[model samples]
Target chain A: MEPPDDAIPDRPARETLAHLRARIAPAEAASGPVLPLGAPPLDQRLPGGGLALGAPHEIAPEDVGDEAAALGFLLALLARRLAEGPGEALLVLAPGHPLPYGHGLLALGLDPGRLLFLEAGDDVEVFRALEAALQAGSLPAVAGLVAEGLPLVAGRRLQRAGAGTLLLILRPAGAGRPNGAATRWRIAAAPAARDGAANPRPRWRARLERCRNGRTGDWLMEWDGGAHRFDLPHGLAGRAPAAGGTPA
Target chain B: MPVALAAAGPGGLRLTAVDAGARALGLRPGEPLGRVRARVGSPLRILPAEPAADAAALERLCLWAQRYTPRVAPFGPGEDAFGLHLDVTGACHLHGGEAGLLDDLERRLAAGGIPARLALADTPGAAYALARFGAAARSHVPPGGTAAALAELPVAALRCDAATVIALKRLGLKRIGALARAPRAPLARRFGAALMMRLDQALGLRPEPLAPIPETARYGAARSFLDPVSRQETIVAVARALMGQIAPRLAAHGLGALALRLSLHRVDGAVKALDLGLASPGRCPDRVAGLLRLRLDRLGAALDAGFGFESIRLDVTAADRMPEAQGMLGAGPAEDGIADGTAALAEALGQRLGRPLLRLGGVASHLPERADRILPWRPGTGPAWSPAPLPPRPVLLLARSEPAEEVLALAPEGPPRRFRWRARLHRVAHAEGPERIAAEWWRADGPARDYYAVECEAGRRLWLYRSGPHAAERPAAWFVHGVFA
Candidate 1:
């Protein structure tokens, strides 16, 4: 159910080419500050080498059941963010999310002590804290999980402070629309290599919904957890999409 | 008006020591019982006054006044009569002014069914004079006005011994005004250093400080509302304001508060108190507010702000010698410090949830369930969590181990071939080890356990343990302890 490539959104307003270019360019955020996704095709498409450090990156599950896959994707990004910025802490703005399993996060190479939970009352405070942390440029990354989609205003406001710190906003699957993010990605859970196995590494069909200066395409990302990085599924490397899952 | 403590002297319980009350009644202390009996004695129905009980009451009154300033005690020793001395240098402004402080103190004491006279001055000697004999129940002398305030007071108001006063009267110095211009050399020669010392103390030439009880907080701040606040929000606001006031005082002391007591004086005469114990010492407004929020969350709906709180007091019960830890370098504070703003979130979450946010970490004990217990995840907390060199444990652990029924095995001593837990039989597809776990002998009378990690056909891993040794007795009991993800 992807919209036509050039189809205009309902609230079309005046937008300049320079402003649009600035969105993709990420001048200050670019300076080689991103944590590369490791996939050559995705890395090649992303401007500033990879995901912007101080920019809010929105990620949504492709389907309702792909939460685990989306979570794995987010964790991989966070692990990469932490690795790139050593000795820096990761602030998670999950007000009431279930306790993060220590072993699972440990498997992703995250030290349990390095992760801190921030409980905010509402969406406004969540973004406020995220933006403040981003502007402070203290922590390596500030990520929040909001079940409901954030309004464009809040997302855009967060973008202003996204210079030296990374803002990763995890919204629920099927709950994302275009906003002022530098990049937008949709991830869904793929079938495990072994069916009904205990604690198998999750797979994902990660679709690049929008990119500021990068091309939008679909890629299969699998959690190489112990290795602590995301990789293309065994059979798909620089290849077209296989016909099984539908893209949201 | 003051409440006097009268007891039997040489006379049979006449007005032994009259306060403002007997004085206002035109009655003097040490008056003869015969004259009182001839007057309105029979109708008086007087009860003997106990000095110890009166002193205890005065002590309690001082404790009540502590809500205004931490330094509260008897104005002077027994020579100073029954009066309260409050070292409210910085605290009086909170009630408004010296006059405002007197008004609030009078209102609260009157509301509590007690009579009191209050006087504020630059010197304790002046304040003592004004409180007992200032011609008004309440007297507050502005700064630099102590001389004028003391000039009109009689020599008896100087807090000197009775013999000194009688001796001073013989010199025709009946009023402090008459003695104000006297040459100190002549006065000292005639009346001795004691009399001169009393005059100098009363005139603010020498220091006359009160010795407050030791428990008093050097740093304290309070707010007395013109109207009582019944709502929780208003009370919380008042608490924040007091915190604001106290934080600076803590800073001036070159310290931080590790523990604070917020005492709320309810309009209904009940005092509700909340004591906060911070894991770390800090004076940051947000950090203090966050910790307070955590404490307030504990009360939730149980915090009945009945009638309303007439006053809010914040006393730093315990202070830390070191200043609060902050982010010194741009690299920011390490996770353990939690001082550079990151620590408050962890504390806030821990406090709001009323428990630690992390899962059950392992303890050193060998007891199966007791080995791992849920502890709050504080910044600088519990044992460090390092990944085991061996196989990892399960993420989910059962609150209590449930007994497995109809367990089938080749031998009673060996790991189960198949076990039924919660009516579901799990066939062992793969088996791990029989790790022996024992409980502390002195701690509890507990059976030892042989723990085994077995995987079921459905790929679900289970931690099953057998109680007691095998062979001799009836088959040992098998229970499923935890399920691994």
Candidate 2:
């Protein structure tokens, strides 16, 4: 009986995109990559069709000590992509952090006016505001510091809101996967590279540990103390590190 | 005849001068008085010009005409040829008819002992011409028929001086009718457009605008009675009539008044003003009347209604609109909770102690003493708070600090270990370092204070500071600057 055709191992649960696209206009369905995080290669695979579009991508946050550096680096990449396209705003919901140090974000080329810092008194209000912004289609991206289990249904609802919403959730390590999150990214601090000088400024690296549709590997990086940009660490390109480091 | 009232001297009785005999003796405005004396000899008591009395009479006339229309504008200064322009557009019908209204006005003027002539016409020029040149001589023009009536009057009707009239007479334009017949180009080129404009205005081809007099301010309404209304119920009825005028007008303009000025137009023409202010802008007449009654009760005389008020006018001098904002989807500060709390506190205090006794504290500049102030219940505005670097601030602020004495271990850089407030001694437990803040040195009398953040054993945190240097030549005193909770 042809080994029961319904049991084909490779078939999708359903043709989700064809039916969903029918509901959404073709113009919206054919939109290009989410504003690329100005990071190379990751933008090439998104079907909407850029970097992760519309929902919060879980970012395993570095501890409080590395908060400023990590946020600065993430914002710099986001600002660069936003600057390349028609202007987009990045709303940062700093529920309890020290204002994300406005000077640092401004130094990273994010126009101060475009960076909206809402002091949401608590974690719940901040998340509600984030979800509201996504549903209203008012925000292009919402970056928040989440440190708990996100309700699976809430995550899905936020993703289905609109197309260009990139919710970058900076969660702490071991918070587990953001329930129902499409793509998950982990940013960790790597050792500074050996410059010609004996003592170099402290530098850190970020790796895309578990991308949903792409291979998961560590991307060796270095941070410049001034001119705040990350570049390919010396020579490593398309090559994964031979050994894995301790989990952040 | 021009009857002049003159006060001869401080000791003399008022004298009346009759110019009737002089007019019978062929006297004009510019003719010398000696010739008038030669013609009419005795019984003509001549008094020098009494400019003040003449002006007072003209002002009284202006006030009287306000009973007919609010916009009665008096013409000329110094009591010379004092004419008033009353814009009786829709009001003519109220006094029966235009002719009836004019006759009534003339009778009232004569009764008031004012020698005045009036002309009712479509344009100001025609009216002026009819009043000065055509009154008691020519047929009066029908209302709104300015052209046919003013056609035969002389060109002098254009308000031109003697020189311009003489110039026009020399140009063969003795009659206004002759000039109205001439070609526009020749008329404009020969005499100038101003001459033609006045001609056109008198003939109804062009409009002449007249400014109205200022209306007596009556923010809320009240009706006068022939009988003095001491009854609260009657006063309330009049107040309701006023609110009927107020609420609809405010609603039409999307406004609500925060304060209302209710003036009772007394029978004797004296106004008694009652001012009422609310916790917030409001439109409900009953609520406004409730607030107004508190003030009206203090009037010196019972609201007299000798002859009911001739009119009532409501002016919205102060108002506000509840602004609509776009963002946020939740209900506002609960009306019953926050709104009622603020309103009740204000209303209770306002009703019991009278209006000006309670007020909100206002913040001013950083000059220590002037930083916080209390402004009375009046419309006062404060400067915007600019983001400037201020001294380490307390979480809670006090209106006026209580007097206290302090003892410090170190002279300049230490917190107080013991402080005496209101003659009671308290010991400090944990203390924060001296937050060095200097007085604004630009001022003449500046207090140099060294602030200290000290927590007492009783768990009270006080912002205590010492004024003047510890080792200064002058004595140092401790001031309990502020208390923080």
Candidate 3:
């Protein structure tokens, strides 16, 4: 059912170049600034990846740490984002899970000023808020903690609602089965690095099992507290391919 | 009109409705306004309630109180009235004793033109009672002596409202100590358990825990000067002093904060707080201060330097404890910190451009571009925060969707050669079509769309579509929607 020969799109004219330029220019121009992914390997796998300004991505459940660790991850991310520039804020939608709100976010780096909190008594309100935030573009990111095996259609609807918006759906990790998603990552607290390694850095094991743009693969990222950066495992670049082989 | 700001000092903000002429007419504290108004006539001025101003005032007070402890909480909202919670468990001894802290709070409050009652007790409830009811020298209640200390305060000090006080008075239970000796069953039956709980909390007979607040941040530091200092250099210097303490803690924990909070306590008892965030978590003092300047500007008027600020504290509500293990750093190799820099810049810009204006375009498997979300930078990371595919995608998306002008086609469900958008006729130069996307049946009246990717003479491609009624109904019609590059 290919189009008839006469209907085939002609090789685009140079004049088309002007149009292409006009189209591509804004995408590039709108690029006010991009926050780095804090991890090089993770950044390479993304489309202009880095922490997309005004765009947020989700950190999966497995990516969450032990109660305390998850709290730390959330706070650090929030603090980092807030510190990035003005109008940056942290919004948390905690559903099902009992988030010790006072302990978790406050301890992490939530500024009483930049933080807007909504405690959804149930999943419905949480989802509604997620949709509202996306449509309203009120906040840069919205985090929703959902039950495992939730329907994919609903997830798609939320994604559609947040078109250009980053929605993080926190679900239990390794539940082992596909729940439609553009990109899925798993993170865990790596064992402390062997002592005596020259100025050993703190690291976390992250596996980018799924991505919308391309495959990001498994990575061991070390976070440098003072410098505030995440570096990949040594010599691993030689082993791991940078991008997805084909859109999996 | 001058705004008279009054706070409970070490407690919280409390409002006393005062009129210019009504005071002369003999309206007294605790006197019902209606009765006074009837006596004073229509000429008496009525003061409107100002919760926003009150909350703002309390926010300032909390900044000042932070000098005494880190976890200073305002009492009226979730706790008791006109009081604040200072978890001085380990900090009191530094002030010499609980008595000293109380005395210091009183002196500071008076110096700020706010007269305050003082109290120090084993529990929050007891302290609340002592602060409200204990006279000058009678403020401190030693451990295990809560009952004896609360024995003289009236039932009203139990934090009950006027109605409840009247009920207690009618029942001959005028004193909190008297209520404590009464039978528990009758007390619960008459006033419900609240009265009993307050009594028990005051006596330390029940465990009354303070609800801790979560800030989603880590590693914060603050400093309070004995005298208010208005100089920007002084504020930055204090911020540096605090950051110096916070930096090592962050490094030791292998964590960094994305946000920093700077609170300035003015000498007039007015408090102001400024928040700064980083694009990434790093311990750079210069970077933190740079971001804070934006927030300071937002507080322009309310942030009056006054005589100057008496204190400043920086707090980190979020942090990460990484297992130290470094590797090489490069553009793509060190992704974590790189984006952090941009995030910092965005945070600063967000303040000026207005936060909602910043947005990232995420991929959505739907026709409507508006359905896609625009998110802020600092929300939590959850599942589905990333993009996922369901079907047809437009390369160029219009900021706002416009209706299609025509739906003529070569085949029944094919792409159109020409269409009008926003009242302009666009001759199709090339086209792709019939990417069918059925509406979710489980959803409420969702529409089914058969989308087309059409490139017009202008070389602009669009994601236009025809919306059909549910399969249960006859087929539907078309519309021009998103744009594609």
Candidate 4:
């Protein structure tokens, strides 16, 4: 027996099989953690209790005045996703050359150097550029500011190409038409109650228009730019706006 | 085959050019038109010569010759029979060898229905002489073969003046070899210094300075085909290959192109060019090709493949230093601000769309226009950190300031209470302070401005400014500068 084992006795066949199984078996599927939407009510409405990662999300502004809110939401979300891994980059595709200011991005806790900007003349070019950036797979996410009407084919391509990234398409506020997206949201500026402060903190009204197998909800979202997060309340303090919101 | 071109002479029309066919009939340029007409009679074809049209055609050919070398230059002005000089010292090697290059040049010109004679030598003078009067007409004189090659040729090969050649001939010095053996003192005394300089330059004993054309592109790659190709796929394939050859050089220098020009040398002698610019500099060939594909799609009817392109050249006309990406070592991407692959995306988009697209960084300045500047993000040159406090500016500024019509201030000089912009009237619901920005003295002299951030009743934030003073000799002019989101 000593000659057969050299130094020790062979383990039981059953135990050896179990140990080998532990070492070679595939690890759990990549559903590590859900990205918390931060707004307690918004998270509570979704079955997953948070926004899904590796999915395409749409953030559209209600009008010219709501553009800032939609953009701010995208920036904060991108900043958070990019911060997960060191040196992650974000591609920003916009219409025309009216690019976001470096100082403004810096205020949003994003390094201007990390942002690559491109101008798309139309929706076709926008989707073409977005598809390429996603296929490259080097960036944690790509943000596009385009007027919607994206074909379903483009939406499907984005989903397949974006594996561990966030594909955010920001368009002007319009009808919540189907576009093969995993989630669609409408965002607008929510003016805060006037206080004595020179600059009151900015807030937004985020409404979930469509979610694939997920609950639809609305909330008054306040962004904490410094932390690159929204102030998540405990016990779901974010109640739907008084206006006719998503059906409970 | 005799052909002679007649031009106006002092004694009426005379022959300016004679082809071999005309020369066989004892006709040549400089012969009086009446004499040529008497000599050839009715068989000779006499046509008026147009110097202007010939010069224009030669100029066009010179531009087309740029594919061979950017060092092409015209030997003479728009007068006489003009010749093009191409400094192909370093360029010929790409076409295999000097002989190979000359053959290619001749074949291409012949196909274009233009007669050509070419020669290559260490000196431009020798090359010019060999091509013009050598027995072979087209020759390539080896580096040390200049003296031997030019010796047996006629003294006319020395590029001397007509009078000087006649003088040398009268002295029985018909051949350059005989002239070289003549008494140096008397030769200099009689022939003058110009003859000696020409001889020296042709023999490579003296430096012949050549002025090369200014090339905007420092980096280029060219490919010539054994057979002409017309298919769009073939042209695109060649273009992609040329780009592949050029990118390594750019990468070695740590540079990326801001703009590229793709020149297609058609078999019919026409050159078609496509320009692709980059929003941000990058060294990726695939991205460049992608952009070019988009541009080609947009070109549609504009880009006709034509008989086919015999050669394709890719030139990096404008470029900026683009260092290697981050995460090469362990220093994570967070350390490097701009993300990897962003430049590639920008370049691809710029090619598909027209023009370069970039973000503007506001510089702390007094002038509103000067304050908003297009900041360049590259190595060595970085955005200077300014701790100086500044007033808030708008995200989007109008390309040019448009005058605001019908401006009524709340209290004459106070913030605008109501104004009309772009044919729409906006009522001011809230108003901020008047931030005065003085005009730049060094720049153009313009009236001072008082800017105000006004919130309109429709919830649009407008950055309006009043030019000059409200109490000035004339009423101040109002303009809408930008809109804040």
Q: Top model by DockQ, which number?
A: 4
Off by over 4 Å in 1: A1-32, A62-66, A85-96, A119-132, A184-205, A217-227, A242-248, B1-4, B7-217, B221-254, B258-318, B323-341, B344-383, B393-485
Candidate 1, residues B59-153, lDDT tens digits: the string is 88877788898888686653556677888889978998777888888899899987677788888788888888898888888899989988888
Q: What order do candidates take by DockQ, descending?
A: 4, 1, 3, 2
Residue B29 of model 4 has an lDDT of: 81
Candidate DockQ scores, in order: 0.07, 0.01, 0.02, 0.13
The clash count of every prediction, one per candidate, is 5, 10, 120, 9
For lDDT, candidate 1 versus 4, the one ahead is: 4
Q: Write the per-residue lDDT of candidate 4 for residues B80-135, one digit (tens) a residue.
A: 24687888978988888888888889989989988777888888877777777777
Looking at model 2 chain A, report the run of 10 residues with the lowest lDDT sum. A98-107
Give TM-scores for every candidate, taking all chains together and pairing residue i with residue i. 0.50, 0.34, 0.37, 0.57
Error of 1 at B292 (Å): 11
Judged by lDDT, which candidate is best? 4
Residue-level lDDT tens digits of model 2 in B1-485:
33323444444433334465545655454444555556656656566666677767767777778788767777642213568878788888888888878888888888977666778887777777777777363235686677667667787877766676898798888877787887789778877777787788777788876766445342444454556554555565667677777776666665667666666565567665555666666666676566555445544345554554443334454677633233335864222111322343243225322433212232434544454333433322222232312333432244455667656555444676787886778788756546555645666564566776666664455667666566657446776765431
As for candidate 1, its clashing pairs are: A24-A212, A24-A213, A54-A162, A54-A165, B356-B376
Interface RMSDs of all predictions?
A: 6.0, 16.8, 19.9, 4.2
Model 2 residue pairs with clashes: A32-A49, A33-A49, A33-A50, A34-A50, A54-A165, A56-A167, B71-B213, B225-B305, B226-B305, B226-B306
Model 3, residue B242: displacement in angstroms? 2.1
The C-alpha lDDT values of all candidates are 0.68, 0.55, 0.57, 0.70
Cα-based lDDT at residue A89, candidate 4 = 46
